[model samples]
Target: MPRVVFLLVPRVHLLDVAGPAQVFSTADDLGHPYTLTYVAEEPEVATVQGLVLRTETAWPSLAPDDLIVVPGWRGPTRPASAGTLRRLRDHHASGGTVAGVCAGADALGRAGLLDGRRCTTHHTVQDELARLHPRAEVVKDALYVEDDRIVTSAGVAGGIDAALHLVAARHGPRAAGEAARAMLVHMHRDGTAEQVSPLLRWRSHVDETVHRLQDLIETRFAERLPLRLLAEATGCSERTVTRLFSRATGLTPLAYQTALRLERAGHLLERGATAETAARAVGFEDARALRRLRARPGRTMHSKEASWTQAHP
Candidate 1:
């Protein structure tokens, strides 16, 4: 098994570590050969999340396939020792993968890995990174950037995307998708930036009854949804349930289910899955039906849910 070493710095953001850790861990659960370890400048490092992380100060022997991940910390700055910087640069030069999540890119820049390389950091720090490392090509607002052996990412949960992209690139898209599903994260497409698919987020409203109904449909959407059962779950008659659902979501129950299936089918198609397979997976009787639904006027984002990022926030 190839070993994955996490270089822990002071005042680390727990999720930056947790996100990629969880990604590779989940990939391991899928039976990938990966061994995770941690190294720190000290025996123990403090985290921004009010936790102390115990790590090995002694570096381990790593092969060409081995990896080192630098997770972002709370403060804009971290005290990376001379030894840490040497390991990062040396390992990458020798064919190992080195990656940074969010502001962890700063560490890579300091290690000279970002010099004349395409990279990115948290959006808040991209300009500073570019200014400090004049030779580094820092892509602003990128979900993540990969050049040669180095990978850098944007802020917060963008680490998840970066890690998953690494998994997809190294293993295969199917393996990465499985890992994502195991982690319960929406695996967004690579390149540019993406949030939780607006299709999924659009369903997030405060109507408990509608939420329950939608939740049920979400799980069994590929199967026939019994309107009576949904109505019963909503504590109302079928007609009343339809009215209530429309009032809450501005769509009939069937319309919402169709939308979910269509969106899912579109994603599958984007991933190179055949239309027939996508249709079957998303509950259409056949590819022809899915094709018709795709042709529906205003089938795509049109509701207040359209400007989802701004609409909700």
Candidate 2:
């Protein structure tokens, strides 16, 4: 069994912290043994949602062989303290897999481990990260990216996918699938899937607000969703809604909604809706309008073809 320790700091994103813990915890149910532990700078930490997480171990006692995981810190504007950076560097030097999720990637970037390495963070933080760390190749097109042992995921729920990839790499695809089954979430996605694109963010988090917005958009995608309308509907200020949505889910409300439409449109096409009907069903005024908004970089043919094969067989 591989010993996996999740490291969190004060105000860590809850989903990012919890998602992988569940993935590794359920591994034993699938008969793929792996021990999961929560470690922190201190013996306890507070989550962004006001939950207190009691750490099972402290940083200094972490073993070199243990997989060290870092969930995203709460704020990007605040720099990681030098002491935290030092410990992270030490963990990397000790030859363990050091993984960072969302803003945690910023910590790795600040520690100089990401220099010349391909990495990613929450898409909204891209500009700040590029400005801070020029040497790092900050990728924007992956759910999670792994460069050797240093792995980083794009924002919140992407941490789950990235963690499962590591689980798959270390154990096997079956183990990863079993982990996802435990969560009732999809299995590991191909690395080529859009990472930071608007399409990806709509599917990013399992939070209440995120899911509320997701359901709203899925049900009302054909309707134009301006920022003000979303804010009004959610009872938040437009700016607050946008920022929180971006921070929690890595996308602006409108973009996330559009992505939802595209995804539904995809399903409609897969169900044999003509392009025009698919567009209409998903709220597009015209099929050509759907084409302009389909930023996902491929035809809907792959899904349709798979559906066709299933039916033919």
Tell me, by lDDT, which candidate is best: 1
In TM-score terms, candidate 2 sits at 0.63
State the local distance difference test value for candidate 1.
Answer: 0.80
Residue 36 Cα positional deviation in candidate 1, in Å, after optimal superposition: 0.5
Cα TM-score per model: 0.65, 0.63
Clashes of each: 0, 1
Candidate 2 Cα lDDT to native: 0.72
Give the TM-score (vs. native) of candidate 1: 0.65
RMSD of each: 7.8, 10.2
lDDT of each: 0.80, 0.72
* Per-residue lDDT over 25-54 for candidate 2, one digit per residue giving the tens place of the 0 to 100 score: 777677877788787657888888999999
